[model samples]
Target: MSEPVVAVERLPHALDLPLPAYATAGAAGMDLLAAVSDGRPVTLRPGERTLVPTGIRLAIPDGFEGQVRPRSGLALRHGVTLLNAPGTIDSDYRGEVGVVLVNLGAAPFVVHRGMRIAQLVVAPVSRVRLVERPILPDETRRAEGGFGSTGTGVRSGTDNGGFPASEDREC
Candidate 1:
């Protein structure tokens, strides 16, 4: 299938920087570069957070949204990551893209101009209509079980689907 076209506009401050692009043919997200002004770098001390601009605005098509995700290498190497992971850019948004980065490592991290700070992933969105009802209609064997309800090890003969035998009640 042909790729969908997204309209992107580089702001005045980012005229010298290249547009966001995928590093590999099979990559799912495109690298978003930092557009720090005047060639100055922004430093994030440990436990600090800041909003870094991309200096670009996107016109995402209807029925899709832009997802700003953190780069794994930054998280692994420097303990730097997006404050709001998978930051959502709605279709109606028309402002410069910004990334809220946080430093969780011991040392300070620096964000330089044209640095790949985050990634942009365009994905399809589903709209749903809500219909209120008195009660849910269906039931399952593991209904209502959550947060470690599932056992971590292999089930033994005495295992009652991750719950105690006495707690195995129907929904």
Candidate 2:
């Protein structure tokens, strides 16, 4: 096997701390977050955004991909999550890593620079080739529909099948 070619950068302010890395072999991703106040976290106002730095950028090799995801701790505790959760950083992208976070909880959270905001998981990617087709597949019970299109029906063994059987049921 050949050595993986990945480029990394340490932010000027990241002198005291080391760049994020995984400890175990199964750890395909590393936590990329900042250390804010003991509890306060970063907050994003409605329709507003701030570039929350991850303090590093990677040059993922071809045939590979980088998935930027929200750190579980941040999400569960603060309701702060990546606006574009699992955002893809393609191999060709050469930009400083940033997680676009949004505050979905009722209260605002404070985000300090150098705080760990998200994580980056690197994985292998396979390219799919497309072939032109004159006609598309015609039909099926759930074609082109979503959310609850299959009759909004209940599960096979469920009593009501997810739909009200009568008008008096207050469906």
Which candidate has the highest TM-score of all? 1
Lowest lDDT 10-residue stretch of candidate 1: 155-164
The C-alpha stretches of model 1 lying farther than 4 A from their native spots are 152-171
Score candidate 2 by TM-score against the native. Answer: 0.70
lDDT at 13, model 2: 49
Model 1: per-residue lDDT, tens digit, 1-171?
777789999999999999999999999999999999765899999999999999999999998999999999999999999999999999999999999999999999999999999999999999876654334346545555567766554333423345333422243
How many steric overlaps does candidate 2 have?
A: 12
TM-score of each: 0.84, 0.70
Error of 2 at 62 (Å): 0.6
Off by over 4 Å in 2: 1-5, 23-25, 35-48, 137-142, 150-171
lDDT of 2 by residue, 1-171 (tens): 876768887656455556878857887678786633334555676444566766566788999889989878777887788889888999999877777888776677678756667778888898876543333334445544566766875333323434444433211
Q: How many clashing pairs does model 1 include?
A: 0
Query: What is candidate 2's local distance difference test score?
Result: 0.70
